[model samples]
Target: MSCLPVCTQRMKELAKERELEHGKRIEWNDWVADNLVVQFEKLVFPRRSQLPRASAVPHWEYSCQRLNHAFVRDEYSQLTLIPSVRENELVLQFHDFETMGQKSDGEIIFLDDITQAQALPSQDSVLHLLPAADEPQSAGYFCRFAIRDRSNANAACITPLNSGLLSRQDRWKRPRYAPSKPIVIDLSPRDLGLAEGFSQAEFDIIAGLGFDSEQDMSWRTRYPTATIYDESPPSVLSHMRRGKLLPPQDVKAGVPKVLIFSETGPLVIGGGEDPYFDLPLLNIINELNASEDDFDFLVSIQPAGILHPQCLPSFAKAVLELLKKRNSVHVFSVRLPDHGISNSQTYIVLLASPICSDVPWPATHLDTKSIEEQICHLKSKNPRADDTHPTAGKHVFLNPAGQVNVYNHGTGQLPDATDRPYFKTVDFESNIILPTLYSDHGWLHPTRHDILTVRECARIQGFPDDYIFYGADKALRSQIIASFPPPIARGIAEAIRKIIKEHTAPGLDASTFAALNLGGRPQKRTRVD
Candidate 1:
């Protein structure tokens, strides 16, 4: 084999070791050459049919290093391939050089027109130049590549070269024909009627604080359709919080085509003196009216606050009434069993659209009784009782009244009969899990006789095990308890997607239509030839 002088030294050492182990002479040079050929073929052959032709190639980088070895082989020296754009075509220049500063002849590959010499499969190879692996367990080389489109400099796709063909089954696809710009307004307590003793200015300042990094990340993952704006000045949130309408220029720039207002908490109707029970809703509505930038659709999810017969109009009912006045509205109820209080709770979801005269409500049926029976069966089998989980196998004592026995750990004794007020144990066979699972006097595990862990509570709320929670244990527990179930949310999302698909005009993009109807401003319709 004609090996580079630098590579010969390392190959000689390896050859000597192998010969000694086999107790025979070996033609190491020929073996190395054959191995290199096999490796090159494996890397280059599979992708021969996939490469696009006559297209402007984006900037990309490919690198390979010797696997499980500190030193790189002479043939595996870094090769920098840079592509320059010429006449809207990609011109890739390939350069090979040694670390010792010796440069070899260079080659240029024209994407639009490849020469006969450059058209060879071996010449077209980029990853195959790396050394071949000797064993199944060991990779001959580790490869990495990145591609960045010139039009979107900030966006880049990076992946392992040996990742093979990735499956698209797990990819999340947005709703087709939906609005291009959708905004989510997460209302706080102050945004509604409950101020918790804070003044209006103070409440606005706190509401304007916006989400933290973790929250921002979680929200983006949860609501892929919603547009999350930067918290910087002159943002949509800033203008909305200050009770100011978006300027015409801003509206024309990227007006929100869909608006989702979310509020989840225990609110009371006529509980406070504030006449405007839904200040945030009113503010947004007023702003849109002033700007004339009506959203294509609006969705609201809010708790059915403490009901009062004398309150006249509850927040949920009032909001529904207001929405119906402006556009076609569909309403749905989401029921949640509050195990902590042994009561059934309900929340309202409203979907409103301007262009569509009638919208179909998303059908959702959750059988709490059936779900409870399944939970009971699983608990009887103790499926989750394993050493891996924190709450597994832990025991708690419950009284006949279904209250947990609060043992005083300091004294190592049970509290006196009078001191131990009966507390309810969570009835997996009857009641659904509630957010108050973290409360000291709240429900205990139906079978385990212990407080429910964050993950256990989250699972009961229809959250996947992989969904991450950030913060202290207490905070995580609270978040899991307070969240709206994912199953119901998904059903609602699917319904909205269907509505968009049915209502949108064919061949016209949603964003283009939105721009044309900006602020309800009338534009002369010109016929295109």
Candidate 2:
């Protein structure tokens, strides 16, 4: 495997890891190719006389690595883009690659001419950026290539086409047309890749992609679509205290939310595994304070020791001070006089989740009650999705169903990924206890069991199923499952933030702000025993 060694070595170098961190597994990489080109490029063409066989359109993908950095402090990210067939117009499809896996990046239809087209096509999606198994720094970059020449035994030489140059005639056609006399470009680069980690030069190179000076003005253009924001002011708790909220906010400027997800702790499959789950969240909070992108009307979410009630007021004060220089942005914290909420407008979203789904489910084999009877209330109001599915539920709609989850799928940064959690396996036999249900809808708790399955829990927490986790053992599994705050809760907080901003901003109607886009396919409900 000459190709394998090179590919493997190159990927490692890019990630900047000298050796594989303990428990880290490479997921897989995906290759993108055009279907029409695959047919035309073939030597044994179906005889014009032989009717085209009824079959799926030919398409292709190349294998990539899947690394579930379930416990790595520093994370790696990759972005892929595959454009559909079109004329000279520069239409681009984008994807965020935080996870590892062979994703279907979409088709790469070739065009004949550039000058021939009258208008650019609207964003015809291939796939949205999935969340990697790991979370990535908010400040990052991505690139994409069209897969070419997969037919060769040596797949290393495959290259992508530069859309900047194309002829006009090949842009469009009827059902009868095909790739006539044509040209092709190599999509893959000759070398695997060079250098590791971001430097000044590397950073600049990645940043320059689609460099547009006018992007600032277009950042948040006025659109007919109403914005979604968190309506309640943020709840800032101290980690030392580790509890709930004091009260509410009138303006609801900002609230610090703390999320507690159970995990197997840290693992070092190799020498030792090292992943700081809360690092990215912390970094983002710091950024919100330094910037003035209407970022104020939102409360910062963080990881307070045991819970969010313990979040420090010092952080809020510091953030407010940072915005002192900016004329528009200003976020402040509200103090409570007593035990209840300080004000009715205060918002506190306590996102608590188990590390996995080992929660002892009573009916390992269905008998009296249907699976719908096993549905998790915390996941959805619907009780029939997971347990009584097929009859009551159409598809799983527990927590995550966003274009954003695709961007974060497989790299193992996230603690509460749907497919894989931070800790997959935990020594149930080794632990001090056996399986038992912890709460109300309780059947038999799987140790990691709460109200939802792993995916169901992830969705409610705002993570797509494709997002992978780390920790392959039961102890680790439980840890990852319980460590995260629910995504639904986060989405709620996000909505609340936006609502507060709209109300505070002059002329913006409070009624309009209430119409935030937070709808999704509802989960089905079934009666459980």
Model 1 lDDT at residue 178:
28
Global lDDT scores for all candidate models: 0.37, 0.23
10 residues in a row with least lDDT, candidate 1: 196-205
lDDT of 2 at 334: 13
Mind sharing the TM-score for model 1? 0.43
- 425-529: candidate 2 lDDT, tens digit per residue: 322232111121111111222342422344433332223344443322233223322332223223333333333333233443434333431111111244232
Error of 2 at 494 (Å): 7.2
Candidate 2 Cα errors over 4 Å, as ranges:
1-294, 306-453, 456-529
Model 2 residue 259 lDDT score: 18
